[model samples]
Target chain A: MTTAPGSDRSDGLRLSGISKVLGGRTIVEKMELQVSPGELLCLLGPSGCGKTTTLRMIGGFLNPDAGRLTINGVDHTHSKPERRPTAMVFQNYALWPHMSVAKNIGFGLKVRKLSADKIRQKVDWALDLLGLQHHRETMPARISGGEQQRVALARALVLEPEVLLMDEPLSNLDAKLRVQVRETIREIQQRLGITTVFVTHDQEEALSIADRIAVMNNGRIEQLAAPAELYARPRTTFVAGFIGTMNTLDVGPAGGGVPLDDGALLPCDTFSGAAGDVCWIRPEDLQITEADHAGSVRAVVLRVIPRGHYREVLLQSHGSTLRAFTDGEPDVEQIVGLRATNALVYADDALVQDDEPARPGRAVRAVADSGDRG
Target chain B: MTATDTAPAAPAAPDKPVTPSSGARSPRRWSMLFMASPPVLLVLVFVGIPIVIGIAFTLGYTGGLNSIASMLSVSVYTANGWMPSLAAYGNVLSSERFRSDLGVTIWVTVLTVAIVLVLAWCIALYARLSGGRLGKMLSGIAIIPLFIPVVIGAYAIRQFYLNTGFLVSLGRQFGIQLPSWSYHTPGIVIGQVWVSLPFAVLLISSGLAAVPNALIDAARDAGASLGRSVWSVMVPMTTIPTVIVATFTAVGVMGSFTVPYMIGPTSPNMLGVTLQATFVAYLRPQDAQVIAVVLFVLAAGIGALYVWANARASRSSAVQL
Candidate 1:
């Protein structure tokens, strides 16, 4: 599914059964992906989830222990990084400190043995495109970090490679700059129509920029879908939880219905396949109402934290704690009802069936500790 | 475009309203000056006094009153002819023996600095890139010379390169006639390089440490080979450290006596050896003093370059931060 540059109807980049073993541990496992021309696909996951490793493999910085990578329909699994038609904007923005901004951006073109005029034309275009024209003659060290980040993007774009890879490109920037630079990157990607693979731990960044998001954990893709589809109908528990806050409740069959914690039996017909399924309701989807309102579960408010746009209300039901977002302030210790909307159900730990169930218990406990620590 | 419009523009301004806290700050400033006086006084006593005495001696004013007058009145020193103090300097500068000695010193310094810098760069780059047991061992071996006494190291080098030295004997055992390298310019340069290598390696290795691995990776991703990446990226980025290495090595080699004295040829000697000979063997103290001043000036000129390089490095780094 690879096609050369300027070819139409191309599968921009594909990874089939790609796996990587590092330090006797599989950092990436059997990752399969396909991106159409002019699409930005994000590898979204928490730290150590093999997202960066996958991006590196795609960029030819790391070789897959197994499986193959095809770019524009040609096998590049064993190609050296320089030989691949891929460019990466490193997390640290890796701009050459000794070079001027123009030199840094034109380095790749120069390496390709382009004529000075050709290199200058492309570099100047990138400089104007990224709004970095004023800083072209300044040394990289003299510019701001946000400006350096743009220079890094310009450098990669000057090559006009088939696939652009970014490893948390905005991570080094301040919060305000991160959003600003992120939008700049999105605009550039759309304008150039270069197939792109962006790796980031920030779910919002992925949701805002990517045509599709691949939620990964423990070296495997948990779910790969459009951001709305993944958020509204996550295929797995990890995907549901990682993409955003998911209030997961353990469910079991009781008579003809699935029983929840607060004496409510959800209709079993919708989740008939799995016996021990986990229901995932996003915090925003869980509407908090007065106790008198018709609801799925009754809970006592534990705390309320205002999040500017909405107030996050924490609730306790039986032995489980759940969170919900509300527009109004919910009093602490007040009994309230939580109604789930757009809830999803997945067979618990199905992707990791070979893993022991005992580990999840410890993982849950660790999550609790970290939650309390925060 | 809207993103740029709303972005928190550069960093926050560093300005803060200043209050006049003279009562609190004056005592702290005075205390700082007081604590800093000892080293300043020590340098004035040791280095400053000797340089003043040496300048007076070179001006042909050895007596206390005449030296004081020479220091006070520059015209008195220059009254005989233009720059009368430069007579001894001119005599030494024109001497055939001194000219050859100066050339020898310059050649040895240049050769030693070049060799030492190359060796140090290779070793340091190896250590930085490999980062394995071999890398650690190479790094350890590079700094071993630093712990060895220079005299002992110089003597060891002489033994290794002499006609009946270890290398020649080893060659003889293999039925080879190896050329004797004892009492030669190359022999002196070898000794100087060996002694000067540790500091150069340490300086350059620290620079290599400061280089982020990602920058090299970026260069590689830009289609540069490993060697090209190092040459274009690492070499340019570490210019200050390299300058520091070259300057320090040159100064060390220019003023060095023990290594050259131990292994260098007796004829066409370096400045260090010739200065000793001029003062002790020929009993020409004034001429030797002239040579010493010239050598000091040459080393000081290099030292000034090092200071400038260091300042530039710091200024650029500050801008980066």
Candidate 2:
């Protein structure tokens, strides 16, 4: 059999209009996404948001009802998982309980009928890469959860697959182990430069590990961009609320902008279809001050919680309650004022869809101004 | 912890150091004795006593070593009121008819167990993979044969093998002819297989269900071929139940009376039929009892072998776990 050329390093894995129907219910709608090569793309969504289903479709475990999946330039929608050069690490690890770590890692090579000596060499290399050589001969059950996860990664990587698909692989781990293992996974993916698609409901996991995060909601992609970019300039209200902490405000139209409930006119560049309302500001964007800063709005400090490195201040402004992440603890008993500048405004639960492409310079200016001022 | 500290310990303290009244001691001891007596008495009366009696019987008497010694001697039969019955052993071993009958019984048992297991595994696999209304219907269909009386099953199988029956009619329609059922060994095997297949399938299906789905998916994801997945994972995982089913089927086939009796001809008589003929037709209860005892020993040996193998296999799996 002629070996297929490596498509792993080529950027732009395009999923064009993919949909899936299962048990008479539409699981994944017409979804489209393009993940750059060497990019750790995470599909972040709540449970049953079709995140796992979309991953399975890409893995070829389930065939999409209608779609074209192309990695680099190769159309692989109909290919089997083994033939597609994709290796998946399941949430539960799904390591072969009957096989030793070495055997589990060497399984793909063995299936391909590699020489026994070559298989041993590759298996050893993979185990060493994962720092699991000491547990090479140990069965999966004999190892710790972290070690089992490492074994799973080693098994997937041994084949040198072009794409790595992870479905909540760290969720089974304890809280502490989850962070450690997730970091390890990110490091390994970066080092290998594999085109990885990670699926998780944990927003922190997606934001921390992924080069780009694709926020999914109701069987459709809400936004796809760099982790920080998506967080800072979320294209939809769902992405804004889902990715990070946000405080929504209800406002009515006033002076070509929106008037807050407290009768402050906030200048908004765009308006949602629903004319009378807009959601404003993220927690980190707001700052507590002795006096209102430039373009800062006044708010009452309701509750202040000291959270180790930062203090979370909940404030009420214009009949809407907002939370602010302050560097130091603010006066809780005294009536303190807070102001948020350069806040992103959302209409309903979605970002205002603009007809014109966003001006990058203006977006950067907005974010910089919002940085410390709240 | 708080609840425990708050509760009074006075009731529990009284039991720790008992200044026991004689009245309390007698009732407490008697109650304890009463509770323990039934199970102990049952064991002695049933298991312990029978085992002692069986050992005594095997040793050839209820009494002394002289009786055992005399029982072992050639002249013991002549000395005692019991007749010289060495002929019974000779008749069982030397007679070509008896040897043929034993061979037929063994052949039937082996063939029946083999066929039953194969068919059962197929049914079990179908039931597992296609678990829906259709699967339930197929499962119900498989059990239909079990509900049929063994005599009726035997008769139906014999009829199906006959020249004018369904098999012959179907064969005739397809321009083929079948052999008559009168003396067919294969027919006996088929009947036994049919009767035993449901139990095998039910046992094996339950075993197959216990195999973790994660294991199957792991094997598939690791690139094991479909056939290899079934053999390496499914079959190995369900081996214990399969062996159990096979053992039961084997023992059942070996001792089956109705199917072989109703369908098997006189010339190629099975051991059960032969034993029946000896006892009922020839008025030889003593000889029949000897054959019956031999059959019992053989079945018990097969069962023991299965139990031994099952234990070894289970121990290996447990060790792996």
Candidate 3:
């Protein structure tokens, strides 16, 4: 249930060449991105990837040392947080402790100098919308974590901000409550038709909620694409490994149609890349068969992980580990034939400069390590 | 990581059983009181007993029952022939000089408390926002007064404002004639503020520290200006501590003697200095007792406010928990 591309709509929020340096280290460097109106874009990354810092700059908590921030084609790069048309849902759910839930939700309207009647009406509407009528007069600290989260959301929503920025809003929730609240947040964003930028480290959270996901690494956006596209075809190894479970297998040489590490050579028509390329295969793309088969290699099963709908089979062959997904649980130490249904080759940038003889196992490890760095 | 984990089918219900802690609460209550007795006894002996004795003295019960009876009888004969007399209280309240002294004391207390609260809040807010080396230095300087002996501090303030003191001397060097402030109400207030400021600053800083930075950021994100955030968010969140600072500063200023005695005007000084004069200079211990009782009642009023605010703070927190 995601909206289509932003080309049909006006630009809601944009950041061009935004950079921030803290204590002589560049936290965010020359970052450029945009979001369309009525879109939920998730900045998916590991910690220290500058997602929160970017959100802060958009929210006007921190000024960018370079570049500009624009909302609706207007530059607000140096505007104060109060002057910016944005609101944030902090990770800690920073609800005012002394205020009742209703008052906390009404704070933004009151700050805008609205009449008491208007504030009351809007606050009541928000309270009803978030199903917080039962806790209208309850102090935030007296409520459950999920209810507090709803109050934090209502507090921002009442302002009708141009851009709603959420920083790991669901990280504080328990696993079960997380999914419940996640649905609530998504429903509200769509219902309000507001532009939203959500920063999170959970790929599942992004995949489930975002209209588009921007995978970040080392304070840079690696790729930005729809969830389906990002999963099917990742532009970088970091994106492939970070977006979902990906298995890397080594490929030998640039000619002779490329040889696989499992002693099988196939015509390389699916992928074209520089020398010293590695194959990135999703676990679901690999097939397992009987002990001996043509165009397949024999491998001993290492372990099986049951994932309800499917089992993930971990295999060891020629000192390299390979993973495959199947409906059956292959017994440990059982011999099996492995074949690739689909695979995308990526250039091994780190090993290309070494000039050493290509060890298929080492190439796989290097690609996996680079993905881990992201 | 599979999602399909479920509990087994329930069996037939059984009768409820009494919990061990629930049954043990009766005996635990006595042990709780036992644990609390030491501090309770210390407060009774050091604080409660002294207050009782002082009140008794103020009520004309000096040594024995015979002396107390004679004193009360004489007071009754002089006043309205009542068994218990209000003669001393009546006299102290009616005295013109004592009335003026009381006024001065009230004004000084109000002014000092206002000054201390405003300045301390500003300092605390500055430190909280800056959070740099300069902020650290300012906080350190603010707390330095707490370590200085009150007498020494009072003397230092007295010297600084005297005709030949550092301030007047500095003014002379700048070719500006300055008036001496020693033995004046302004000088006394300055000294009292210096002495009382550190406590207010500490309490205010602690309160500001207790509020998470995220709350302030949230306020700003919600479109609150700096002043609006401070008044609507920061100040309200720190109500308990601000009230505490007010109560402590008011009580301390009302009962303080050294600062005013060293720097206040002799004619219309605080009741603390007058109380001292009434007891030692005039040798009127009965009058001093009456004045002291008035002072105690005033301080007790502020103490009651503090206790109420503290109770509300704790009760709300308990409800939250």
Candidate 4:
């Protein structure tokens, strides 16, 4: 869905069959994506998954070996980074160490040969926008880490780039500052309604900030959906594992159930389609209870790692080890019964639809887009 | 020369002990003084004292160390009751020959520094951006001059640009009359540039290479062209090292004797050759020492510029950190 910024700006980023090969290795496969104006789409993946490569290509820093990249109906596949209406906030911020904060923000305008008054006005506005007015005279190195990051953001935002690209921009910040800055970025992106592509390896970060998350693996997009949609109906095992903690058990038709390590058949004919199918369960969906429940598989609590808001219980099952999230801690070595609810099933590395069909993966075409995500 | 060689570098020495204040008598402070004494003592004895005594001799102190030189000279300006005489300074300063030599020396030093810096920046920027084999080879080849003995290099350069040299002969083949640099001001400039290039390239290239790639990329992304990015970002970032090369090259060229003596014109010469000719050929020892003092003052001006540059760079960088 699109948001309010789409109302004023008609520009959107479109990449069709884009591919990149670096050093004889295909860093990004034939990736296709269309980000609506004013939407913040995250290229979410682990290291070397090509998410950053895709973002770099979109930013015009790197050209796609194949495929066409268009923005606002204009082809810019071979355009230089400056020629394209895109600005990137690099992982390291890339602020000019020699320039003051105001100068750093105004550098793009200065390059455009804008009048001094105009450049200064825009830089001041950017400083106020990022709440960095006091740091105008400060050098990048003299500022604190968070302040440096904001200056980098202001430097990009001052350009009013049509497409905003960030390469792990929050990775340099501490955990506390990371959340704060990401929220700030999200608010700014929404308020401005610029089409933004954020690349990150942190799944939680993607789930927290993105209008849609494109999960990548091995130079290909594994799944592209809203956070809830991805968690609920991950198209592949990789998506399920990458997006959240996934517990998979092999299913077969022998006992019309899933096969555990102990040769016990946990009946799952309702969720799976065929033999060798995988029953994917998110930790929270796996109900581990002290008392035996209907259709429950016997498991032993091996470890309990308290995770602030919830406890993560590692269980030794009949056939394999499985992890389940619980509110209360279960004693190690205590036997428990676990049952899956609303689990996804996959066969041959693909979703095997049995009953719960995925919600239609369609975005609002620049009309209904909002910062809100399911 | 030996003192500069034996002294530890001033900056970023890992074990440089900090001085303890308020008479705390820290072992580290003692170590700092001890480590520092060798260069200080050597410079004071071998370099510093001689310079002072030489300056005194120039000011008409023609006794003890100056006695031997005073006996050999014809018109020695003698001091009165320990009062220094300005007659020797007046004699050297008033000479049209000495004035011409000073002017030529300044011009050559300035020209050499400018050319060397430009060439070094070209090579350094090429290596930094393209990182191609050709740039590296060119940079490596530039350093060969540093290894070659200056006398041999100067002599070879003179031969290559002589009136009947290979370059002149080649121009003759094309029916062109090319002016030779031999026994000319341009010849000294060329020789100085050639000899100074190795250090310039070495420092400047490394300084440029040390600039983070992201800053350049960011500049390019900000709509600056490659040249603009280098001018605005890389140049300012590399001020200290570049200034160091510039100052050192100027000093080296100004005080250089071999290249100027081997290649420059006999008259209207750089002060390096004039100082030699005055003391040895004409036997005007006091006047020559006056010229030496003049040369030192000029070089001290450049050295002061270097110190100011270094201090400003450190101040800015320290604030940044």
Candidate 5:
């Protein structure tokens, strides 16, 4: 979706050095985040990673021990939740069980004390926008889960808040329904162009919907980048392992390059700072071939798992297990040779460098021929 | 393990059928039946039998359509029969004494219930807002009255109202004498409220707790003020429990005999005190029974109304959820 020119220039929200200490534990450390106008940022993390705490602080449900929150360049750090120009959709929907769908949608407008006719008009408009016009008179419990989710979304959207905060809004749905409902949410959010911060632990949900994903760990943002950037160029070992599958290899310096225990000399970029080493190669980066292929390390195939488009081979080599994905099936119990076009070296759980030469390596050669398939 | 092995052996012996006699009743079912029997029997005895007896008494010998027929006939009352007893009701209704007493009872009941409900809600809200140590302390303090006997509470209030009582003595030091409990309705109302406030607070507090914290956060995020959140969301969501509490409070106040009997003045009396006076002071069993029946009907009607209103509110509220 394309935005109108100059729309992205607005400073939607900025959280500066936010920190929270609850029950003698640092629930949210000094965190910083900036959301541009018309961008949907997902605060992706596992439970207890402080994503929800950060969202609550921004929404004014909580006061940070030390921080300033600025929205549209206006500091609203100590403002009450009611005074903040943000609406939240809770995980359980949190639709007022005592109000009709129209009333629930128009609750914010009513609290603002709009005239009855105006509230009626706005309520009708919101219900229509959510395709809930027919269920306007129905109670929240009378509606289906998906419809309730829409009511929650409509209730937040009707206020036309500058920022929308959602806390695992689709976690309550079944697998099939979660995908369906998230698509609806994404469409509505994009159409409205409201800057939103969605908190979720599901990696796929975050990657599929967020304009930018903030992978949080231990009350801190480990890495924040565009979805593709996060997946392809993860800055830290945590990000790489957390984002997708990888096969880690232990290596140490041998001859002029790092040598795996299996006696394979893998060239490395000297600037990578890899020492006393461990290196990680993504499974898909590994190419499996029949035995006797030159420049390839031989390993015995342990098992083959069919993964739809590709087969994942678990191989035992030099007392270590290495997983590699290949398009063609390799015979089990047969010695197979594996070669990785690219690998990331890590020392003590920190990514040190890519295992490709800065000047000349297999990755460079492949890029020259096929423009780098991965 | 043994049971599984025996199951296959039973099947192997096709001549022996799987019968209720062959398989002993599951111990689990036996325990469940044992657990269920006491309450069933208790309800049958305490609730069931009394209702049946009351209905029988209402329709049969004690008083039925016959009682109304007897009242209609003048032949039964030639300076005898039920004349003097029926005259007592007429005399009580017409007299200024009756007017004052009835007014006193109505005002006392109203004031007591109002004070109790308001105080209970405030305490409950305070408990809900305060967490950890302070919340626990406040909740513990709120129910302290429950552990104290009703007579003790009445006596405490009585002592507080006496001329030499703490507040009264302090007032006298400032040269302002406080009125005694005998002359004040507030004293009785306070005592009644104190006796009943804990129960109401407990009920309402549990109801408040039942309201999802998410809904409160949602309402606040949607621009609702604290007061608006309470009225629009919290109270409505807890309408059933609140009605239940209020009904209990009303019925309790209507049937209250101890607090008022101990502290109420001699000149103006509540229905409970009046009912006691008819039975004890006047030694009039029939008149007391009639008044007792009236009080029962009033309390029962209020209780029924509360249940009906609560059920209706719950039904409407359930649809919203």
Candidate 6:
């Protein structure tokens, strides 16, 4: 496969302006991308965002109506699925019901005309890799869901494909098992240095499992960057809102600052441009303080939710609701102040600036967690 | 069965794991049996009784209900006191005419069932995989015979292949020659396949429909060609319906009367025609009853295969799930 591991320039897999139209609807637009050798890239988007469609095109299951697909620098746009060096783990874990776990893992090898000894050795290796040796001869239907998932994974991995594709492999699992398998998949992908294209709708899963996350919306890639970079520097309003929970306030351009809903000018000093039209504020960055403090907006507490480790106090100021995380059990209707100098300012759906940082001295040290549930 | 007997039967695990209803189970059992009794009783009185009487008559018994057939037939084998005789069986089985007729019956049945299965599987598999106007039209053509009565279909099949009929005349007009096969076993097989195809296709296609597209895609992605995928995955998954089609077609062809009588030749005709000839033409009711018994036993043997296949499919699916 000419797979030079750690070679960032090697074209492990590339989709040059690929597109798909299903039933006369453009499901995936020009999707230009490249997966370097041994890199794991996640297609993160909501349902119907064409993540799975793109993955299928990459795997040769669905041919793109336009553009080309290349694996290892060879054009494979019109190749059949059997001719492509790619394997996919389906969302439902579509293991052959009639075949045992070992046979399923060995199926591709058998199709490749491998000897019996070679097939058995590869199957045994995969079973051990997935920790399914005890259930080697068990049929797919006889095993538990998690075990079936592992079998599906091992079946794909045994082929040693040039590029591995997964279409929401963890979407069928329970929350706890989803986390466990997600880590297992990531660890194996890293250990084997396989170039992978994983598609999932869960943002947290993409953030945790991907080396680089491609946030897609409306059949277009909104942003493609590392997990931390994409989270910190979301280029679009959709990306900012989609990556995490944030408060959005529509503000019009005004002299020296942006105007709020209540006709009060919320001073956005960090915004140097004259076209800032919306305000984005992370709840964690808001310092709970008194209204009389400098650079703080006056507000009234609308509701307080007990988010397991911290309290989420929703404050109303200038006719807009702002959420802030705090430890104190603030009563409803209590007046408070929210200071957010690091508020992400946007203009016409594009990020303008979020240059300033939160002043920790005045900030109420929030637990800095997002997984806690009320 | 009463609730007490149903308890031990329940302990013997079923193909499906039955939930123990514990409290309402006994009353529920009684109601189920009471509701089911009418049909069972009707079958016992009407169908079940006649079969037993017919077998007794074939075994050389000339008593009770057998007295009527023995009195009417030209020759009837009478049983000795307190013992069933095999004279009627030996008398019919040893005859060269009956042996040849039995051979013709089995040959036609096996050939018809095989052709029906191959054609039905092709049409259904094509419709399922390629799914469009052409596949639908092919299925529609196969099902057209279902709408036509067996009498009309058999007559049409025979006439269409005859030397002096429409097809031969058309071939003659084209200055081409073709052999007419009507009044032969091949013609009878053609007629039987045409009549049996609709049932087989409907059943087999329903099974193929249950095979999910995801599994097929998974197979293809695993480097299996279309043929291998169908053989390994689709065939195994649809075992129950396929078994049902085979057994039903075999049973239908073995005992069928209309198609064979209309299309088969006279000398070595299928047992269905031979049985009628022995009973009415030859005035030998005992010999005809013997042929009927043989056909029933053969059909029942095939039926056992269906039952075994069905039970195995259910048990395997249950365990897998």
TM-score of each: 0.87, 0.80, 0.86, 0.90, 0.83, 0.90
Residue A72 in candidate 1, Cα distance off native in Å: 0.8
Clashing pairs in 6: A141-B320
lDDT of 4 by residue, A1-374 (tens): 22223233364888889999999999999998888888999999989989888988887778899998888767788888778888989999999988999999999999999999999999999999899999989888888888999999999999998888999999989999999999999999998888899999999999999999999998998888998898777888888878788877665333434456756644332453433366776788778765454456667899999999999999887658888899877899998876555456677878776554332122311111121110
Residues B275-312 of candidate 2 have per-residue lDDT tens digits of 88876776554455456767878888888978886887
Interface RMSD of each: 0.9, 2.6, 1.1, 1.2, 1.6, 1.1
> Can you list the residue pairs that collide in candidate 4?
A1-A364, A1-A369, A2-A369, A3-A369, A260-A319, A261-A318, A261-A319, A262-A318, A262-A319
Model 4, global lDDT: 0.84
Chain B, per-candidate TM-score: 0.85, 0.74, 0.84, 0.89, 0.72, 0.89
**DockQ of all candidate complexes:** 0.62, 0.32, 0.71, 0.57, 0.63, 0.69
The window of 10 residues in a row where model 1 chain A has the poorest summed lDDT is A351-360
Model 6, residue B110: what's the lDDT?
85
CA lDDT, candidate 2, residue A103: 87
**Alpha-carbon deviation at A346 in model 6, angstroms:** 2.7
Off by over 4 Å in 2: A1-12, A252-276, A290-306, A316-319, A330-334, A353-374, B1-98, B130-136, B173-175, B212-214, B267-321
For residue B235, what is the lDDT in candidate 5?
81
Report the error of model 3 at residue A66, Å. Answer: 0.9
Docking class of 6: medium
Q: Assess candidate 3 and give its lDDT.
A: 0.82
| Per-model RMSD to reference | 9.0, 6.8, 7.8, 9.5, 7.3, 6.7
Give candidate 5 regions above 4 Å deviation.
A1-9, A250-276, A330-334, A347-350, A353-374, B1-99, B313-321
Per-residue lDDT of candidate 6, residues A151-176 (tens digit): 99999999999999999999999999
Pairs of residues clashing in candidate 3 = none
Q: Write the per-residue lDDT of candidate 1 for residues B181-256, one digit (tens) a residue.
A: 7799999988998898888889999999999999999998998888888998999988999999999899989998
After superposing all C-alphas onto the true structure, candidate 1 shows an RMSD in angstroms of 9.0
- Interface quality of candidate 3 as DockQ: 0.71
- DockQ sort, best first: 3, 6, 5, 1, 4, 2
